[model samples]
Target: MANRLECVDVGTEYCPCYLAELNECIVCSQLQGKKFCDCNWKGVCVFQEFVWAGYKAKVTRSTVFTRILKKEEINEEVVILTLKVPNKLARDLNEPGAYVFVRGYFSPSFFDTPMSVMWADEIEGIIKIAIQVTGPKTKFIASAKEGEEVYLRGPYWNGMFGQRYIKGMHNSKALVVLRGIAQAPGVIVILKLIQNKNKVIVLLDKGKVQTNFIKDYIKNSDVTLVEADLLSEEGQEVLKQFIKDKKISVIYSGGSDEQHINILEYMDKYESEAYLAVSNNNKICCGEGICGSCEIEIDGQKMRTCKVQVDIRKMLERKMSRG
Candidate 1:
């Protein structure tokens, strides 16, 4: 059985810098016996709910402003948020497949939502994230106005596809399969790969592709976007043909659990390199691992993405070691 961790443990100490407003802790380390004073009042506990080790910051609190540059309606259910962040934050997000945790206040509750940086321009200090209206947090983000300021914590490095991984994929057939909004992390990675001159084959759902909201942004792009029901037999045949004919070297699959599993099975069959995104339903109170939420298993070892630097290349390493 895989060991798992849940935040707000009954008898464990947590980081002091844990931001209550965001419902996320700042520490990315394992929470076992760990403590820090976020208030820095000589280790005096600021909040009765959590206790931590005492540490002082020059500025006790700082908020990075995410100004909405534009909001485009992809469809009734999906929206794209274009935001301008500080230059320093943009530099941290230079890599493809990076993500940020957003803190937006809604009617009854506040949320810290993890959104993949669909696209980032370091020079322009801009990043784009696409959101599908499935949950309350997303709905709040979609309701944000162009000039509104949204609280954002990080361009978190964990669980990101590394630059070396992208550089290594030269002159090889790359196929990306995406299903629901949950698997949207592949968007920026695919865009970057295509910009690097890789002729990427994107397999997306027919309904999602046909919708003007999502399709308009993707239309007329240099990449080849193929719309199909990837779960169907014909879809499998098409995928197989592309893998065989194009000599696909790497296949990246995201979206629902079913899509991830199907692609992994397919990769195992063909012995192709498989980079699949695994979603954890654990409460991510902190995108930082300190919260102990969002822990996952790798070769029977429990690790948290927020705590460790996860790379697509490591997935292959884990698979090889298991075999």
Candidate 2:
């Protein structure tokens, strides 16, 4: 009934976890506690076992699909990726806009950073995530081809705020900001939301190309489409105007410090109601909670952003920091 997380330690390796594969083992590796934290697998498993025993969630066959939206010099490493968790494993995850844990290895080519899911297509029995190859773990994920099942175990994290909060937006005009490229978790969130009620989704994107993704979703629905052809002061004002109502929330998918600053000022005017999907930079070493690397304070509570997107805690901090 309650939520839980679990992971299997493949071997006797110390917790200097940095995408334990090769090549990247020496490049910006975390073998010396520079990045990774130790996890008590038994404790985690026990917690999971106590909470949800015989919990049926398995990634039977992960075929790396090449269906991705790529970018040139995609520093954010947004790789449009798709993976499938077994039907049994996915059944328990009835929550829409929730993420299940993945058990897999970091590719030898890229740096170290575990990939995370953005959303689920429960009806199709498929779980999807938009991942960015920022490090070793991600590189492996980006390179993983069709039929290659990655070793992973979990349905660790759920949707943000819960269905009640999401449903609240059902009748309002909302903003979905896309600030990430390549393989970002937001892609999952974006895809699932486009399926929302006709007016539930709002697309706030800049530029000709990026704005196109927003336009397509908006034109199809009655959702308001505000295109920031250029991220200007004018653009910020346009987005700010939409964040005022109670049913409306903003999702910042991609951006720079400048864009973040623009958002900070905008969110400050609104307070706790502002919603932001994690930036592509958020490093999630273990898709499960075993790795505390992705811990981010949301509303003063530390939560794993990879598993937990759509937060307001740090948005306040960011807003205050700018002030």
CA RMSD of each candidate after superposition:
8.8, 10.3
Residue-pair clash count for candidate 1: 8
TM-score attained by model 2: 0.54
Candidate 2's displacement at residue 243, Å, is 3.1
Clash totals for all models, in order? 8, 26
Best by lDDT: 1
Which residue runs does candidate 1 get wrong by more than 4 Å? 1-62, 105-110, 159-164, 206-222, 273-283, 309-323
Clashes of 2: 26
lDDT of 2 at 163: 31
TM-score of decoy 1: 0.68
